[model samples]
Target: VAGLPNNFVFAQTGTYTFTMVTDPNNQFAECNENNNTLVRHITVTNLPDMRILSQHIAPSKLNPEPGEPITMNVSYENIGQSNINQQMKLKLLIDNIPVDSVYPVNGLVTGGTTTVAIPASWSSSLVGIHVIRAIIDADDVVNEGNETNNEATRSFVVGSSANLFFNQFFASNNIPAPGDTIILTARIGNNGDLATEADVSFYYLNDQLDTLLIGTSAIAVPANDSITLTFPWKVINNSTVLAARITNASELEFTYDDNRATTLIGGPPQVTVVSAAACTGTDGGSMTAVVTGGKPPYTFSWSNNASSQTVNGAAGSYSVTVTDILNRTATASGVIADSNCCPPCTKAPKKPSLLISGMSSTGATNKFCPGDTIIVSVKIPDPTACSYSWTVPPGTVLLGGQGTDSIVLALDGNFAATSNIYASAINTCGTSAIGTGKLNRGAKPGTPGSITGIQDGLCDVSGVTYVIPTIGGLVYNWYFDTVNTATGAGIITSGQGTGMVTADFTSAWVKGVIHVTASNACGTSGARKMTNLKPAPGKPAGITGPSQVTAYQAGVQYSI
Candidate 1:
């Protein structure tokens, strides 16, 4: 091989060595003996080479959502054997016109080149199609034999960033309960040239109108696409008015013009305590109240002229009022209203509401073991039509009375029994809440003692029977085998008693085996084996004395 000529204006060319080898018989005697007769030739050609030297963008093109930071990718490639050293620069261009800014490029390439990032300001004006070009220059190479100053240019279009937009914004209720999570979803759209990252935030207003940041999240929106972003805001006990906002952090700066949106926050509806049976009483009674419409955070107070009764603070079906705040004023009454509002302005109940006070059971402990019977009974108002239903825990079966207020359950394995009681006032409009009782069965012991005394019989033995020993509180299962022709196999037998079980085979046989198993509440015992049975009796034979045998032989000898 030979190197091509470097500076030829016309077609550049280079020379290559050729070799010839020849047989000794065909060569002339005077010719050199060391030279070969075979001939081969090679040639080299020179051609001008051009390749991308370097590329870049003015502003670094990166993961910018939309209309944020302008993104550009600069690249370079080896054009000639000479090493290229230069300061590369990138510019954003629209319709062949240079954009406002320029990004400087810096790196070295010996043989191959690489791409680099260029940062620039994103432009909202360049909406549809825009091009960016990277210009690279050697700037210093001037020697004759050295490679000429090289320049590389690459063009690309800028894509629109992602944008968020919504049709409408609203909140279900402004006032949320403490520890409650509120989910707010916003319908968003991608309006920019490229996809953008959307962020949703929830804010709450303090008494000073200052917004307290509640939550924020990053959401993905495709270019020219729309999606909904859901954000959950946790409610604190002291929270009052809560609001929400959505933004798209694309390009570099946040875009609020076409994508940003907000919603109005409100409080929970007001709850009114219509009337409770008696806030203070000797025996526990029900408290009845009507929940009025208002924002949440409503407070309730009851008066019964006694000091021992108290009440639950939140809104619910029942509040345990153990103390009476209002002393004896000749009249006992209670007031309920929004906690933030003053008295009288809040709605209060006029009369006491009827409520079932107590329901309980005493027959069985809450838990039981498998196969153990449990009796469950509950106490409710005497005149009410009360019904009971039993729910068995997983891996258990209820023998009977599946849907009854009170029932007996047999525990099996690790299972529990649950009873739900439903009561209705004889003529009341609403039914009372269900009361539940649970019975748990602990772990079960290992299998009980094994069966014993199994026996085998011979072929032609029509049947074989064995009595199972009596085992108190233990169950027994019997298995037997009979011989057919030559082989013996196990057969399940009927009429197997629990305590004393007897197994019978259909055909009598020699060499048969019987297995008996005993079981108890804990578990089953190992089986016992019996082998080898006596053959059945056939015809009977008679025996004679020695003197009778001799006389009979002498009398028979003369005739025979």
Candidate 2:
């Protein structure tokens, strides 16, 4: 906690002591357990030991100009007995209320001085007494024995310097032409106390003004002193009048002088075109005029100038004589206005329209496999004496005849291959619209091949076997015909065979017929059939002789 009251104000100069006490509620539990209260002492003395030693508010008055910087210096001093470690802060108050801090208080030592700059916008109003107060706060003291708080306040007035003045001026022409140099001069002076540095720029306001010569030094003038500077300029071309003026000027901390002035320089005499015209085809054009100097009310006349030629538009150079307002006459020459003749109108030959006659594949019977080569030809209409250009689809391998109507193509792995032909004919005019033809490769269908040697029999017994036959490029299918009505007929079996066959049956007495079919990619072949059967076994005859020989003992040798 601080030792001073929150709102304490000191009026008289005296030494004041304060004591800072630690919070009583916070206690050390282990060390110094019983006596935990801590207190520290601080002292503050109200003293008027710091003051504003010197202050200079620039111009002494306010000038209402945009973008001007105002500077003020508040020189301060530390008159206290003890060294002060606190910074001497400066605050600018408009009406005893702080608006901005010109210099913040920090890291300031005793018996030192500093300056603060206040911008021009801070005092932008008209001429008036702007109470600018500089307050110095001594918030830090290094000596513990001297308990004193030092502060000081001072006020100054800002005056107005609205009158414009020149600071530094010069004139120069980087490059001067013959007989066109102009002599220029400038003056720099200050009406205010503040010192300023500025640039006096020169520019050509009128094209007729004399061109500024080279090697002109910029002149600098001190406050309240005027310097008359002069330089030469050059005039080029036939301008009647020339002008020069000051372009820019500036001042430091006090005011800015944007004052400008222009002067008229020398130029060439007057040149005039009295009359001008364009001539008809084959006929020549003419113009006449009178040249003049020294100005107004000039008269003009031409020698041997034809009015008919003047009336018609013609192209060529002509001359004339002119009289100035001052009664001075001279000869002037100028070109007559001419009409540009367009090139001779020749009718452009009409472009022949592209016509597609027919598109056909060059392979035999127009048949092709997936990766076979095929040629495509597109017939273009015979446009007499006309140029033609042919175009084909991308990836179409051109074996021969490119830029013509026909191009050969190799089929790709895709299902279909097509060629588009663009034929255009060009003549004297523009090229015609393209005509295209599409050629497609034929697609072949897939078919199953022949199935041969179908046979069926009872289950679990050897029976007739059938073989399924197929073409080299075809597939096969096999089906069996059964006689049992309870079970389903046409039982399919699994065996892909070309010539050999074998079969087995589950039962001995069952019989059936087996059928086979085969097919290829184009079409299915005819069905083949085989029959199966289980024959009955012959009965055994009774035992006769051998039974009778052994029947003596058996008595009744009946058919045993």
Candidate 3:
């Protein structure tokens, strides 16, 4: 291998050995024969070999709108036997002028591959085909296997564009009244290569989308074209501002600052209350409210459950409110009457005029029975104006409702043939005139109460008189026990048909039971029973021997 070429290359990169024999022909003798040979081994390999595998433009091989950013990508691999230890620069160039740089293969190992990406924006003025290149180690700074294969190129066209924006916005009128209808219009511009659709939306400045939806209009415009959109708006009370915005465009846009606009809107509703009237005596006066500046059909509501524009009743303060269709409200309040306060009006209410209406059971005779209960009701021109009190005879017992419009009384034995009851109405002002009615106790006597005087027949059972007491105005029938009487039970005796009885009891020393019945105009009463009747104890038997023995009163005592 003498005189080898200067640019010699290894056919196959690997380790090689070179040997030199200093005394191969034995031209000189050496002390040791084994030390006559010299040998060296070296590895032969190519330089750091790198090659561009692919060049790409993002949205590859297609046209992009001017002013849009584009991405340039280059893939490269280290195909040599040596590894690269330094940072390698991958540069992106447009028309052979460096535009961007990136390190694609930093410390690349043998047989390694990597890709570098560069993003660059084109000016809107660019209108033709552009040459973009990606170069690996472009400055020959890296000793690669092949220097000629470091760069990659690609070409693409810059096309036109479409941008959507709001150009003009206006309203039909700046000032609107409550409940007025108005129109709003917006103009949109499309500055691009194709037709596209966009949303033109309307808004009330301070209202939410759900509460005040002015509505949205969709419009399609040709490239480099403009369109007008119109919408209807109803003017509401207290509205101050309106706005329009363009949104949801179907294509890429050049700018967004001009897509929205706002305008001033004026006019609001107003409300007021007018007058309230005073009250007079027991009657209530009215109050009114006046509504001026708001949408109508106006409505009225009063605090007293009255739906009319005016309110009335009872002396006191009153209030009323009026509302318009737009929901604007006003209120007013005042005293109905100067002197009338609630509860006990300033001037005391007039006393009730009372009259005796009738009794519970009054007929042509105006009569009632003993022991009967009757209700006496009184009449008053104004029942609620005052309280009532009823007065009955001294012996009459008032059972219930003594001091009310009516009263109940029990007719006891105290009631005579004729009696009178009185009633009167009373209030804070004064007592009403007296009212009276007469009540006649009828002839129906109650059951016989008791027999007052009774005695055993000391003289004889015959001609004995018994006095029986019973309710007045009624007759009685007496009954006697048959064992004591010679006649049958219930036989009317000498006192028959009267409250007294005289009978003869022939059965000696026997108990007698007596009964009596009272009858009147109403009917006969239940019989009353009386027991424990006996003839006087039989005359003691005459004592004979005992009478003969006598002793002197002062000095002697004798026992027989």
Candidate 1 C-alpha error for residue 348, in Å: 36
lDDT tens digits, residue span 26-89, model 3: 9877778898777888666455776774333342333576676666566777776455546667
lDDT of 1 by residue, 219-239 (tens): 777777777666676665333
Per-residue alpha-carbon lDDT of model 2 for 1-560, expressed as tens digits? 12221235533233555444354566434655544445444444422255553233233334434334455544555444333434444555554666565445443344554455544335433443345555555233222223232333333234433123544443344233546565656665656544444455455533323345334244455555566667665554322323323322334323332455543332324665644443222223445443333333344444434322122224556555554432455666666665433223234323333332222222234434344455544343343313346565564454543433344555555424554546564444445666655545543323333334423324454434555433342345555554632354232222332333444444433465655555432234566655653333224457555433543465554452
Runs in model 3 deviating more than 4 A are 1-158, 207-211, 267-560
State each candidate's clash count. Answer: 95, 57, 9
Give the distance in Å from residue 287's predicted Cα in candidate 1 to where it truly belongs.
Answer: 16
Candidate 2 local distance difference test against the native: 0.43
lDDT: which candidate is best? 3
As a whole number from 0 to 100, the lDDT of residue 70 in candidate 3 is 63
Clashes of 3: 9
TM-score of each: 0.21, 0.21, 0.23
